[model samples]
Target: MIKTIGFGIGLVRFANAACTSGDGLEGVCRTRRECARIGGTGSGRCVNGIAVCCVVQKYCGDVTTSNSTYFANPNFPNLYNGGTICTFTIRKLSDDICQARIDFIAFTLAQPDANGLCATDGLTITGGASTVPTICGDNAGQHIYVDFNGNSTIQLNIFTGIAANSRVWNFKVSQIGCDCPTRAPSGCLMYYTTLMGTVRSFNYGTTGNAAMTRQLANQNYGVCIAMQPGYCSINWAQTAGDLYSFTVTGDSPTAVTTGTAGTNAVIGALCTTDFVVIPNPTFTGATPGAANVDRFCGNAFQPLTTNSKPFVLTVVNDANEVGDIGNRGFSLDFTQQRCNNVPVIG
Candidate 1:
């Protein structure tokens, strides 16, 4: 097929002796026999030189979220393998008006011909009698927003042929109010932090889509964060008389450098070489192309203060920066706050 690659998580070494920071892994030297001996438990498969030892990921089942939240393909930013079927159900929360919004930033599937039909690996979304058309093939980079009104549950089922594979897709989903005001996204890729926990990215900006996250990424990424940081925001909405403010906080591999940059109230110090986070208020955002956004990086944060949901935040691998960006992955964590009816799509 024209499309194929079980890519994601750059393998530092191969199955047998592919990866080794030094002289061979000392034990796993390019053979199933040697790998099995060292693994000390059972036999091993030397696929592409690396020993198959790690626990394989399971693809199936239900995903319940608090109120508004985000979700993605089982192993996004990586190619989906063959003959695998998985289903995910995003359960609804109480504040949700029985409505859900799914904003797809990137989606791709396998197809053999030029026709619109997807005869290979693909994914489909359905809610009761309503079902999103099965999507496949180069539908990689998109700005699609789906609204499930009058529905209680949203489900996704994906599968690949006996010998088919597909690229990755990423999206943000949240509960919506019966009616609310809305605005167009200033940027393409979006992240909606809710009252739940943290939401991670499939990659970063580069690999999946650039216009939204910032720098582009190469395909061989892992559950690892994108080495290239990008932009994102939070959404806080008020319902009835309930209201709350949130402080954004996160952590990286300590491998990310906190370089020297300008000190604006928005983004913290500049760490062009190290990863940095830039925060901005909704009414006024960091101007495009000018490194003026507030930059914050290092092991911890000062808790970028926010009084509302959907606050725009940016993570960038400054073109001027360099060094051990490592996996570029970071853990986005924030204290729980009460939020709801925040729009995930238009």
Candidate 2:
């Protein structure tokens, strides 16, 4: 019995009295009757105790127009048994909103197949300018940025298999206005704005036999980092200790090493299947014989620094994962360096 829930956006008025709930979530101040009509719960008192602070939550089959809405599974945090389809649509809070960010607070579905395809279970997002890959598995801490310029509504469709595996998913969607300075670029799947932060592949953090086929297939998108004021260069270093830290290619997780700590550029043949692109890369202290040292792929990562403005990293994956069985994905740390004016390319 597959229950189909269609989620879409509609025109809804904003709450006149915005307030914060007891658990630190944003809510609107409303009367008890108004709150219950929209299936919201009264978390606390608001409007100087004259109204209830209502925390609005949308479940399967519900369409929400409110900003910062929590779109979750029915009885979220609890696993929903297989054989169900949940869909939801989110409309722009206003016409000026340009982007929406979906943060996976708690997402767990059936793992992808051997070919890195979401055959059994998957979640697909539509109505965005950028193409997003269908994803499954434990992606609790990941987030996606969708550009919604020409369209006012975005839809989320979740399909679960008939198998006995239980699934759980909970995410929050926050709208970003066009004028917002921190908005993500047009085609970036993920965006970071801080001076230093970590960027990991989807479904990262698993290891060994259990991690085989964790990487998503048919993915081609940018992971952008906003340039901070006065920062002239950025340094990228893969997280140490995990052998599969940079394993986008190779037979086994440790079968390939493209270059020695960014000493040489990666060849084109090795990156034919999947690769991460560092555009116009520059390194300190050594000059290689190659003209371009931009693309990176393989089981090893070479630490490199670049002065590329509007810092961006592009990740591309092919349609199939035939030889990518043991690839666990990548986790990289990026730090923006302040302008020292000593010439970055020594």
Candidate 3:
């Protein structure tokens, strides 16, 4: 609702010509000329001559101690639009030793579309002190609960994919040992055993085991990938397009600026903060050394399903952040081939 002009002035309105609607919002515009004549309650961007004013979810912020409450994506229970990016920073309450525990009342993420593993649309949690795994998956709509250990703060990074399959998440923010409500009818996040994996997303300070690290080498190039949960592989043979190579080309937004989950090109390399630590923060398939821990923002991707240990890997989302419940959405398919593997020969 930004209007630089005075109301009721003799102004020629061009924001939206009455032909086709964009974003279903009344004041949306589809052209630069229309965008010049400000309209709508959000920022304006013209896509393919169609201007859409995206309204980011307002509830997300640097949240402190909260008793118990509910929050969700910009339009909860409804499909969120694509090309959305939101980051939420959370802090521990009043110097408390125990970090806040997050209980995902309802968590639903879009699965990989026809293009392949959703390398763009995802939710990444970078913990402050206590680490939580990044949660990005479409596991048939599951309930997840996690404790942030003793992390001083945590950051929640969420991005929605194309409008086709975005999901709304509901959550409760409470202390580590508070008396929360009963679990949802389906089931709690009791599934704690992370077995072998084929596709995984990693953050800083993660580690890998031998089974995952066996596929690392000086062979293939690293690609920036932001994989979601739905693209896990179990009985993968030496498939034509399945190989394990690891590398993190850039940082958050920069890594995904150009080539994306579905784009058919390579994104430029732009890292931030610092190059990911080696050995300990182990997402195997990438840097050679210790066991491969994960395939995350800064790491490379190497196909681990070898002829010998073909089906021994298990996909794991290194947990962290995990606090935000409301965000517009993420945009995957930004590019087509995001660190795709070459043909493997046993």
Candidate 4:
């Protein structure tokens, strides 16, 4: 909550009259109210020698990005040419004092070049310069803080030298107060898995193949998950199999399935299976996008199990092949939580 208190010139005279008991001692008073009465406001009255003052109050609202700017290299399409810096100023509308946390979401769309491409290789900003505080790698966004210091405005900066055409970039700024606990930095643990099978020609478009089956374990709160087709990159043998169905089960052991076989079957007969699954993944706000991999394909469930704890994550890939030989494969990576030497508050 926010509140403002003050009085105008006329109210000062009224206050002085009440304080002086209507003795006409206005000119001898030092308070602004006294001066107003002596200045000829005859309406001044002393009601029980008490004075009234004006006060105003207002509610605090959401924080907003009040200003944003992008700075590019002066000599684009030339040596050492690219975006140099980006800055944002966020403001909160409130009469009360509050603090805010700022986070920069950056994406690159530039093509790969000898300069190792403008990959989101962690929050480097610039190569070999200085690492950004609270850096969370390239694909994922980085979190920063801006103390209002009881002031009306705050600013944040994101300096970069990445080639301008690599990926798309976006940012989100949120106001955090004492009510929320600060998040801890954790390391990522990646796991790999594989499956194999065979398919018949009839399983093509005419009738979906039920032979292929895939299942992933439920996720934990504060965690995120993603999946992608594997083994497609290599020149592995391909086949026209029946329906390609993938099922994912949550804590309740219920199954959710999607995909079609034959024409819809994953293009590669044998490809690497990739999925991003993390328990208790923290997000700055609502509708946070998947950071490292493709979007989620199965049912979205709470990251925590019924017991209110992290759940064991599992992925099952199933595929079928015809002719003399057939094979299916997959892999997974799990990120582990890491502790940093962050300062503790009393």
- Candidate with the greatest lDDT versus the true structure: 2
TM-score of each: 0.34, 0.85, 0.34, 0.26
Candidates 1 and 4, the one with greater TM-score: 1
How displaced is residue 222 in candidate 2, in Å? 0.9
RMSD of each: 19.8, 7.8, 19.7, 21.3
Worst 10 residues of 1 by lDDT: 238-247
Q: Residue 268, candidate 2: how far off, in angstroms?
A: 4.4
Q: Per-residue error at 170 for model 1, in Å?
A: 2.9
Task: Give all candidates' CA lDDT scores.
Answer: 0.38, 0.78, 0.34, 0.26
Clashing pairs in 2: 7-87, 7-88, 7-89, 8-89
In candidate 1, stretches whose alpha carbon ends up further than 4 angstroms from where it belongs are 1-59, 95-98, 128-131, 143-149, 183-346
> Candidate 3, residues 1-346: lDDT per residue as tens digits?
1322223655333333222234342223334433333221334453333344432122445344333323456666675665677666555554533444444655556543222223446666676332333344343222233344456666677787666655666554544443333321111122222232222222111222212221111111111222223322222111123111222232222333343332211112232211221122222233332343322223223223222211122222211112211110111111112123543222
Candidate 1 lDDT, tens digit per residue, 1-346? 0212234764344432222223111122333443233222222434453443321112356464433233446665576565867676666655434455555555655542222234566677677333344555444333333344456677877777877455565554545454533312323133333333443322222122111121122111111111111223332121111110111122222312342111111233444333334345232222322334455444333333343323444444322212322232233444333335443332
**190-245 per-residue lDDT for model 2 (tens digits):** 99988898899887755543537778788888899987767888998777666567
lDDT of 1: 0.38
Off by over 4 Å in 4: 7-81, 85-170, 181-275, 278-346
Sort order, lDDT high to low? 2, 1, 3, 4
